[model samples]
Target chain A: MEEVASKVLSTKPTLFSYFRSSASWRVRLVLALKGIEFTYQAVNITKDGGAQQYSEDYAKMNPMNRVPALFIDGKCLGESIAIIEYLEETRPDTRKVFPSDPYLRAKARQLTEIINSGIQPLQNLEVLNKIEDELKGDRKEWAQHFIKKGMNAFEEIIKETRGKYCIGDEVSIADVCLIPQCFAAERFGVDLATFPNIKEIRDSLTGLPEFIAGDLKSQPDYVA
Target chain B: MEEVASKVLSTKPTLFSYFRSSASWRVRLVLALKGIEFTYQAVNITKDGGAQQYSEDYAKMNPMNRVPALFIDGKCLGESIAIIEYLEETRPDTRKVFPSDPYLRAKARQLTEIINSGIQPLQNLEVLNKIEDELKGDRKEWAQHFIKKGMNAFEEIIKETRGKYCIGDEVSIADVCLIPQCFAAERFGVDLATFPNIKEIRDSLTGLPEFIAGDLKSQPDYVA
Candidate 1:
């Protein structure tokens, strides 16, 4: 533990991310909450004709060909939720993203998965593009449907769990996941007004410096 | 910890599961691997006009209206990964599902997310049904495409990390997640021949009693 911690402490981190990618924003938020400064290496997933994430180098770093891959301790890690949990585990002393109580922690994770797996994956860029280009479907409607359905559940869960944040005032992984999904929700034209609880939670968290630092607009590669 | 564990130990668990739901099977595998006995309360997701999961009763337990909501310690928990993590944390003395080493644990989680978020969600029953019914898209083609794409990434990551299991000789959450996904992959007509590493690992793990016990065919609600 000491050896690994010392090695991690000595080396700065590098985040490979995209400005509008919700998953990328999740890792950025975690890094902000942890106060772990790192070099930001942007991977423009939408710019190139084929997307930079599909390039050989980026694919080598993340076989999933996705953004928000963290290069830390001389190793590359991908997957937003996994990277968030890794940060939480390694730096426990930092702002804790998980709850201290067992049930609350489980609830926080449950809420996080509502966004991570339930909402975000369904409306991700790859899925949306596939729906439009190949499936000849309305990508906007598809994204809105799933996002609204997920937010309905998320709103329900948070209504019982909220106290200023998703899990009783602490800024948990649930909150980290929520703010980005809400961004995607509005982009898809989903009416956030339908989910009052989610709207309230999003409003409360977006003003925090940690969340602000992770906002899509504050990103290094932001366009428009 | 003692208070929670004692409460948990005093009461037997009840798993609300579907016969072939990949997410539900994940929690079953964890419970089996941990040697925890739980009552199987089958919630048929396919029966009647609407799935039982969407019923008012089940929705009260899990607003997501998903199967495999584990009722344990006097609380209902949803999200298979969250339930798995809760079990791991609350019962550390049981047969471990996460790797002890920090980095290995992260890798295990990364691989799990590759399936949990990347692959499974894309090919899930709801997504497939939606593609077929509303979008008029070829659901099988959609499932096959996402499953194969995700398997390609899953195979790539495990190649660097595999050693009898996803992270090492011991079975980890990665392996638990992989087995169910392979089940879905085969169902979607994804040839296991392409992902030999995943196939090999899946083959090695399925013969174990714990996995077999969690097999869809082993479920109370299994049809065929």
Candidate 2:
């Protein structure tokens, strides 16, 4: 089934992505959930002396020099949230990733923004590199401090708004954001048990076929 | 006309805010644009020895312990983005701050998120305070560096997507975000002339009645 999905997706639109990138993981989950076929064009950001920076072609596709650029119907869109939303709008026949009620949609978007803004940038590879190179701090300790702070905030946010999903009983864009952040948190040894709400949401999300298939460990380039 | 709008709005809701906060400024712009009346319940975050730390009542409304919490129709919403979006949804008849097309809407939101997540947090008071007290840096220099970096990125983003507005010819949520951030940038003396697109948008936005009313100088607590 996994092979078939990959093959079919490969024949459709293509996503230029890195397997380990949380932003790319978000777009992948949306594609899987929507059941939309799309090709995964892997650009290993870590290899060949940083593929994203060295590739002239990729830079043209995304001037911001970020991963998870999508090429659909010959037009390219950068920024993971923008790409996901484009997919959501273009393929409305698939499951709706955003809620219908404007207020609820805003709530869902707010949750996604919190993770995107509050947590991800703080622990991004570039920022961590700065801490190690310029600040002269133990990389592990700095990463641990931010990851813990972010997760604590995530726990509070989840407790306030979650139900069967991040906003309520429905899986919206918020869930797509939650999973990857959780993956990053666990890698930093932040202890998922401390955030029961986040753990429960992660558990529920992992059980879904879409999420399971989108897992970094399940990707073609999975190292470990 | 401005007085009447303010009077009508003042009767509709109450906002818990800090005078110098960009997040608070974002909500204030939304309220003014929507023509909603509200009272400003000032929480001088820095006055008389850190008032926000002692405001347990405010914490109940927002577990995140952030400012610009809105109480509307007896319901409280935290997060400035969340509150502005809620107002847009609940009062769609007033004025539509979000675009109807999903792609455009997503693009506008992407700009908003980039500022909210990518730029704002890097220059936030809390983060700057941490850098000063804990990292032992010149607070003024550190603030200027981060604010300039964030604004430069923002200028590039605006140049790419902007039309008559941040996303297009219409004023959307992105403008609400842009105004406050520009104000913050000016406060840090980052030289707006360096960013022509941002300068143009700022010029256009300041001419509008709603934005003018939301200006920090026009607020009830304006020092000048």
Candidate 3:
């Protein structure tokens, strides 16, 4: 069994990620939650047509050339939510990140999508950059407007099903998505006071060592 | 076994859906795929401040006031992708919409997210309405720009990993997402010739009886 396992896990997995990407943060959280050992390979996306876009090696790994691509054993996986769910299905014993009950699982995934699809994408670095460059909107104003509107919608959803976490007292995938989005919101100077539930959840999760370890400030690429 | 099964399947499910929402379309696809019958409770989102905003009952089901909320056996589920995944898990035999292999499953999910997070949200009716009402841009030009850009990205992603279907030869959740997005793009006058892979897949799927049955054209509230 050990020999078979060694062959399966032959090559060490490396995560091509950035410190500030919300998508990367979600994958990092999943790695910590699942106790999966992997190397954190940082790609500084702000330099030279973006590191992920220009690097020949990274392009080979992910043709989409997006950050948060996981090179595991010899295969590459892109998309943060998909990568995390892959981990959940394969490593169920490390910790069950998803609820067993289908209804509860749906509720958890719904909240996760609210953050992933609704909030994170609108406030992404690329989108903000586009608005700044193409639309000639002030970067600061564009970030603030999108963040505030997205956070307002997130707050309404959070209020509906939140308990100790984003979904009924469990530290599921929804919490992983929430923290990074809130981090992005704060970076844009969006006030969290108006969203009591969001603030409370963010505060609670930040206190955990697992979440703290996954913070952008603690990543290998952290400048400060 | 029949007694236990009847107890489990006794309750009717409710779905909080909008007349012509792509997200709602995704949930409807899942219901059809799973062979799970549901009560279609329409939330007319274009009249009298939008049914989602004013309907107290709908608000209680999904505080976010988004459509495609599913009430299964008296419990409400929201987020279209999540609801679909929930149906897949509970009714695994009806039609296996997700692959069992973790990596393949992740790829399928990644394709779905590309549609959900990357494409659909940007081209949503509400977002377009807001751009027209608040941003004071030429609505047609803005719509054209976003639809083209988003479809371009979708086409590139699909070209990379698709086979007979989105992920493999089988019909997965990604196909469910792709068809509706293509439907919306055509409505917005996006030139499909530029995206051969997308056009081919869309045309092939649209020809299928299952897809045709689930199409927006077949819905009760379809305008055309």
Candidate 4:
């Protein structure tokens, strides 16, 4: 920790995140895997009606008012995928989010999208509240439904693409998205028994030290 | 049409699209801006419960079962942001989806996410149907609400980011996501008068011949 902190002494990146945020976890996994040092600034999304994210000061940095905004390279970056990609582009390392081949890169990205755009937003905290309060729908059940449906597709993609990871041998962005989403799914009581492919890949990823460190319960701000 | 066909003799891209699909339109804008020739295959998402996107054949190509899956470089790509980034990466030319600078690239992508994930999925056809059939909510009102909220954020981002286009004088992927989202918002009865910055940027992009060619009514599959 001392050595890593010394290396990142100049303008250390600060990640504004919430402990339970799946998107923040995605960025955390990437930063960990890339071996980049960053400071974690916990933004409690459950407090003050998520007012921390929407406060005038925070909104100026990320107009979307979402956590997991990375302050790096002298600018603030919002959106987990965007922040990860920016890190990948600016700070290139041995491990990459996308592979070298264009087709394989597309494959990794396709999987990233399956979670980033396809599944996550439908079951985001805000959307779930809308379902429960305004729509009078069971938020948990609605979340379970989308997670199951998306996991089905994700498992199929994993079945076809997996080797040591979600796409071939490397740990691409797909694995980063997969781990957090599975965590979110389980929280909503989604049955992962049928998604053996996703389970297998996730089992492999979550075992890694970096993956373990980035888990929801392991964060500095996490509470029972 | 014949001349355009002749120009793209070998390995022309096939874009699975629907005339009114905002996600599909997003990819369309990028292909057009980059002058990358592609054949359009309309997968009528509004017909037969979006079955065309879910067909075994299409699912094999894109497991997420969404349109704007680009069959290019001998592979299929889904998710508009991912597809556009792939194109930007592979088809490196003077016309790029993001600017040359890394920070600027992050800025472009931040706007892209602001629309791609923030707004579109909230007002997606499936979500709208869910709002109506399951939630017993007025779809139009719901669409308007989300779109307006997102656009307000979008307008702020645009105000800070815009030059001649969304990011700068050059057209970017931010513009690509912006045009389609504004188009979708208007369709859902979202009045654009409040979004002067977005309206101005859309006005500039829509005036170009390439952008005009990518309009909803101009696509080969348009009806009514």
Candidate 5:
């Protein structure tokens, strides 16, 4: 590692996050599950037109200006799945986010990508606002429409795949992604009742300590 | 593997794809780069409101009902990134989509995720239709806005990282993703001049035979 990179990793790494952002919540759960210590910097994405994230200073760390940028090993990494994979690789001795078998590992990733790429981005706050403002659509209704489509697919896959969690009896990265997405889906008024298979797996995951501590209401930046 | 899945794999693997989908193009590049021969089954995304993909038979094969679903190794995998990773893992001895070094591998995935999750979903035909029909916004304008934002970030990051590809001298997954996205962006009227580094790298990759054969026009489903 470069001297600068080594030094940053040596310190308590900093995580830039928002309290209610599903992407940010996924990262927080990863940090907690891996038992990594980190400082939290709240970038108020909903304030001043989400100005804090787009500021000149913040853009230096993350050009996309998205939250959940983790600074570690001398690099500022953006994208939640990217950051999660980095943590998993660099610290393999820690709790794992994947299975050991390549096929099973691939299956885990397939489930995670279904959310990370498939569902979560569609209902993101920025997209929500764009539709609400430019199209005069109800933001909550727009969110519900997309989330339900995602959950409907998720229900089919998870039914065949779930044992104790999204993959099996163990918690993997897929569960980390599922919890927050399920939370956001319910927040937008999509009844979890629509997805029986997913809701059962989600119910089992929500009570764990790692998940409990990462709850949106428990985060430092949460106002309500 | 199940007996039926094994039988399916015994035949040439099938790619469930669309002629113009950028996500499908990424998978085609990976298949060609690995020298893996596959049969193509086009699921037209623009016909009957994308009804073919959602039909009972197609959904049985892929619950997600998205194109670029790969039938290989006795499994049907949806989501482009997941299929790519599966190919990389199942055939590690083949051409890789990631770097051997862990940190660099993480970086490659970050770039791929930026396109897979960031730009593509926002400009999805479904999302665009929702905006146009419900919000009275121009679909092309919505696509241009999000594509430009993603390309701006991609340009900045690739400037610091590119050599022959999106990482360094070697071709990586990031390159696989960037080439198609740049094409889609240009089609939607985002000027490539604004993203010089990305455009330069994109130009280099497009010349490769692996990419050339996967061009939208080369696919059997292409109209022109």
Candidate 6:
């Protein structure tokens, strides 16, 4: 069963991904939440001398040259938030990723963007690489600073909105975004204890089957 | 009429914004497109010994401490994308920002995120200040690099998706996102002539009153 699950492929819905790319993981979490099956095509972002995402072929798939571009519904889509929202819209019958109320839905998106734009971009491979190249600053330190700042903001907002998750009792798109960032924070050596609400939210969501399915350890290309 | 319009305030969906914050401009674009009247309250991101957004008072309104927090629907919503999405959902009677077609809607959002997450966050005042402080790198050059790279990707996608606007004949959230980034690109000395599709999109959108109302010069606090 492990072998079958690990090597599953054949173009049902293809996800071009790097196993630990949190952006990619966010999409995977949504797919798992929706009970969707997909072919995992690893695009080893850190391998091959210069990040394979920069290749002409990958650029054609996503001109942005980033990962977790889901080739579903007869078209390829990029941007994890957009792809997640698309999945929510198209596969509403399974489990809804967004809340039904318009305000709650917007709040969910706000929390998602806080991580998406606020934290993830600041610490991602590209930006960290840029910092390392341009300033020769401590890349890990840079990542830690921004992650801590963003997490502080996330903690502040979640204090008001969380209820076993980022929005309420239900797991919204915000929770879908939260788990990956919390993983990123820990990987970057951030003390999650400083962010009690976020840590609490992370603790609650990590045990779920959907989130577990998309975690770093579960991916086909994961390396210890 | 000019006097009334310029000082329009007193409990009509307040917007806490900086004139030059592109993120803030995005929400303003949507409001103008929808013809929604909003009371503009400028939060000088560069004033009063630092950004007013960092004040204890303002942080209560927005934990993220960023500009363009909109007070509407009897609640204060931060994160420009969240506020805009909220406006779109509640005020569907106005000029629709997202398309009815699911794929196109996703595409529009994809383009929005490409700017929202990809470009804007990379070049915003906070990130630039970080770059300047840590590396002493030419901040303009840093901004230009990311802006050009993102615009390159945007141009590529729009080449396939362009009509009269980013997705098709009608305007979209993509177009809302496009105009501000174009403004930022030019500010950072990125020659838009290279990205003809984006340039054309910008040219077409800039002529509309909606885009103009949200532009840098249109705000109450324009300095130059």
Candidate 6 whole-model C-alpha lDDT, 0 to 1:
0.86
Give the alpha carbon lDDT tens digit for every residue of A74-156 in model 3. Answer: 67787888888888887768987887767778877887887788777667777667556656556666667656765676677
Q: What would the per-residue lDDT of candidate 2 be over residues B64-153, giving only the tens digit for each residue? A: 566777777556677787788788768868878888877667767666766776677767776667556766655566557656665665
What TM-score goes with each of the models?
A: 0.95, 0.85, 0.88, 0.94, 0.95, 0.95
Could you report the DockQ of all the candidates, in the order they appear? 0.72, 0.37, 0.47, 0.70, 0.75, 0.82
| CA-lDDT, candidates in order | 0.87, 0.74, 0.75, 0.83, 0.84, 0.86
**Native contacts conserved, per model:** 0.70, 0.40, 0.63, 0.75, 0.79, 0.88
Question: In model 5, how large is the Cα lDDT of residue A153?
Answer: 82
Please report the interface RMSD of model 5 to 1 decimal.
1.2
Number of the top candidate by lDDT? 1
True contacts kept of 5: 0.79
Per-residue lDDT over A129-183 for candidate 4, one digit per residue giving the tens place of the 0 to 100 score: 9889988999998888778877888888778788989989888899999999988
What lDDT is reached at residue A12 by model 6? 75
Every candidate's chain B TM-score = 0.94, 0.89, 0.88, 0.92, 0.94, 0.93
lDDT of 6 by residue, A1-224 (tens): 12222343345788888888999998899889889999888888888754678877678778998987888877889999999889888886889989898878888888889899998989988888888986888889989988887788888888878898888899888988888898888888999999989888889999999888999789998998
Tell me the tens digit of each residue's lDDT in model 2 across A1-224.
Answer: 12322432443777777778898899999999999877777767777657654466665555455677777755567678778878877887999998887756766766776677667777677656655675565556766766676566557766867898887888889899989998888777778898889889889889999998888877786777
What is the lDDT, from 0 to 100, of the residue B117 in candidate 4? 79
Clashing pairs in 6: none
Better of 2 and 4 by TM-score: 4
Cα lDDT tens digits, model 3, B97-167, are 88777877887887788778877777776666755665554555666666676566556666766888777
- iRMS (Å) per candidate: 0.8, 2.8, 2.4, 1.2, 1.2, 0.8
What docking grade applies to model 2? acceptable
Stretches of candidate 3 exceeding 4 Å from the true structure: A1-10, A54-57, A138-153, A156-160, B1-10, B49-51, B138-161
Question: TM-score, B chain, candidate 3?
Answer: 0.88
Pick by TM-score: 2 or 6, better one: 6
Name every residue pair that clashes in candidate 3: none
